[model samples]
Target: MRVVVDGMGGDNSPQAIVEGCVLAQKEYGVEIIITGPKEKIEAELAKHEYNKNAITIVDAREVISTNEAPVKALKTKKDSSLVKALDLVKNGEADAVVSAGSTGAFLAGCTLIVKRIKGISRPALAPVMPGKNGPFMIIDAGANADCKPQYLTQFAQMGKVYFENVLGVNNPTVGLVNIGEEEEKGNDLTKAAYQLLKEEDINFIGNIEPRDIPKGKVNVLVCDGFVGNTVLKMYEGVAETILSEIKTEIMGSFVTKIGGVLLTPVFKRFKKHYDYKEYGGAAFLGVNGICIKAHGSSDARALKNAIKVSKVYYDTGVLEKMKSAFAEEKDTLKIDE
Candidate 1:
């Protein structure tokens, strides 16, 4: 398997990206193509004494700044590193693409270059979390700001396919995100989506409110990009803040210091559950190619894991399965029409 990475996309570009590529090459035994300024990438590679043949560089002179608008960047920065890496996926030079650049830029580049699967209205970013019972997936985790009820059902179907095939979850339970558990508690979109999900043959588990997220109530949660984004960001922020406060409280005084010493192992265990690095990255699903959005602050280990996740996604035949599943639905829709 081969993966193309945007070498200049992250906060610690060239260095961290190159290092991660080296690690991934050594571990996963997959060809890695790095797209960025050739000289800079080569310099970083020189710093690391590794098997040079395992990695290749795709020279790209320009870069799209994170601040630029998504569409504008895609149109103006045609030769940017992100665009070039995506082009490799478009041309079949690489099996998957990974980047830590502007989320909007990555989305635009993926949509334009790799394109979306036919019969799917929108591609969603579906990320899995380690839940109490098993792994859970949330779609449109920050992708589509506005959504139609039909689009959400499609997200559910895509999420189900992801959980079953890639995540190894059988007949995953799907839930609509809402203000409350009752079917009539949310806005028109949620109400409609709730109805649609209940009517579907998949394992629709009624409404899942934000308060129920931590209890691991469902395996798949569906929502619009705006709502999903809010939930994810807030979840992340709350975790960070809580961790910070715990650290401060533990180290505050001598008595607390002694208590912290006694609780050090337990604290470590708790920290592992909330670590973002463990999951690697969020995937942009429904697109014709595999694209992962790594965290902006990712270290080399996280990026290496992202590459590993890409390999798993490729091995699982996720894209093809999603296409076939949605195509079947579209066929039924046409019959009804």
Candidate 2:
């Protein structure tokens, strides 16, 4: 599969992006087209030994900075690296696009350029995060802040499709994020959403509390972007804080230091298990084409994994299955017209 990457988008820019492209190409044997200034892209590529035929570069001089307004940048800078990379997927020149750039611009470009699947109300950000048992997905994770009850139902449906097809989880349990497990625990939105989800054909597991989320028993958790974003950020923040504190305490005294050395392997495994790098990027689900938004501060390892995501997405034909679900499972996937 051919994937277009935004070379000028991330904090590390062309360096990490180029390195990741080379690594992804070498390991996955996927064609990569990187969009950025030709000179900068080449300078980084020269440091790595890769096949010239497998990796192509498209010169896009403009770049959409994080400071710029997403919509205005999209309208003004048609030749930007992010926009150009997205265009490759939109125009059928590439199978997917991956970026670690401005999340705003990337989401806007996906919705306005690549467009949404027919009958889908809006595109949602679904990030597969590390949980107690394994990885769990959170839908509407910082895409649309405000949503209707019907929107949450759609998120659950899309999340269900993702788990079943891409994740190889048959009949994955779906849960709505709420304050408590009861149907009447949340506000009007959750109350209404709970009513709608139960009628769907997928495995609806009722309401899931934020505290119980990391347990990973619920495969897919659906909520409005506001709640989803809050949960995601808090989850990340808590993990980082706890890990940092553990390191600090371990180095505080001789006794702890000795114990720390003994448990180094366990600590390393724990950190790796919770690291966001293991998950790579979040998919912009409900779009017509694949768009994987990598972390802005990602290094080569994370970027390589993000590119690998697109390949798996392509290999499994997830988008086709999503379309088919919308077609055949019309009642379940639809929001009120």
Candidate 3:
């Protein structure tokens, strides 16, 4: 499959992005089109040995910075790496678009340019995160701050499709994130969402508390972007703080240092569980075409994994499956004209 990557969009820019594309091309056997300034992208590519035929460069002169207004940037930066890369997917020239750019801009470009799938009110950002049992997905992660109960139901549906198809989870269980585990514990939104989700065809597991998220009680956690984003950030912060404290304590004294050396393998494995690079990026589900929002600070390894994630999304025919599933719900999703 062919994947278009925004080579100039990340913190590491063309270097990490170019190297990652090369790694993905070599390891995954996928054709990559890197969009950025030709000279800068090529300079990075020349540093590594890669199959020239498998990787192509598309010139995009502009870049949308993180601080810029997403909607305005998307409209004006037509030649930006992010916009051009997305255009490839919109035009069917590429199977997916991956960007380690401004998250807001990426989401805006996907909605305004690539467009959302039919019957989908707003596309949700679903990020696969490490949980106790394994990886779980959180939908609407910083995508839509305010949402209707029906929107949460749609998120649950889309999240289920992705978990099963992309993550290889069978009959994934869905849960609405709430303050308490009881069905009637949450506010109007969660309570209403619980009712909707339970009646759907998915494996609804009722309410899931934020405290139980790390336990991996459900395969898909659904919430409004406001709550989901808060959960995601808090999780990251806690993990980082714990790891940092552990390391500091491990080096506190010679005795602890010796113990630390002996426990290095265990610590390494534990740290891997929280590494964002392991999951690559979050998928902009409900978009008409595949769009992966890689972490802005993504390194080569993370970028490579993000491209790999895109390949898996494309190969699984996820967009087709989502389209069909949403088609069946179109009648229920519509409001009176």
- In candidate 3, position 103 carries an lDDT of 92
Instruction: Count clashing residue pairs in model 1.
Output: 0
lDDT of 2 by residue, 251-296 (tens): 9999999999999999999999998887888999999999999989
The true-structure Cα RMSD of candidate 2 reads 1.3
- Once fitted onto the true fold, the runs of candidate 2 whose alpha carbons sit more than 4 angstroms away are 329-337
Candidate 1 residue lDDT tens string, 1-337:
8899999988888798899999989999999999999999999999987777779899999988789898898888778899899999999999999998889899878887899888788888887776666667889898899888888888888899888888787898998889999989999899888877887778998999898886666998999999998888887798899989999988889999999999989888877777777788888988998899888877898899889889889999998898888777786432210
TM agreement with the true structure for every prediction: 0.96, 0.97, 0.98
Report the Cα RMSD per candidate: 1.9, 1.3, 1.2
lDDT of each: 0.86, 0.92, 0.92
Number of clashing pairs, model 3? 0
Any runs in candidate 3 off by more than 4 Å, and if so which? 334-337
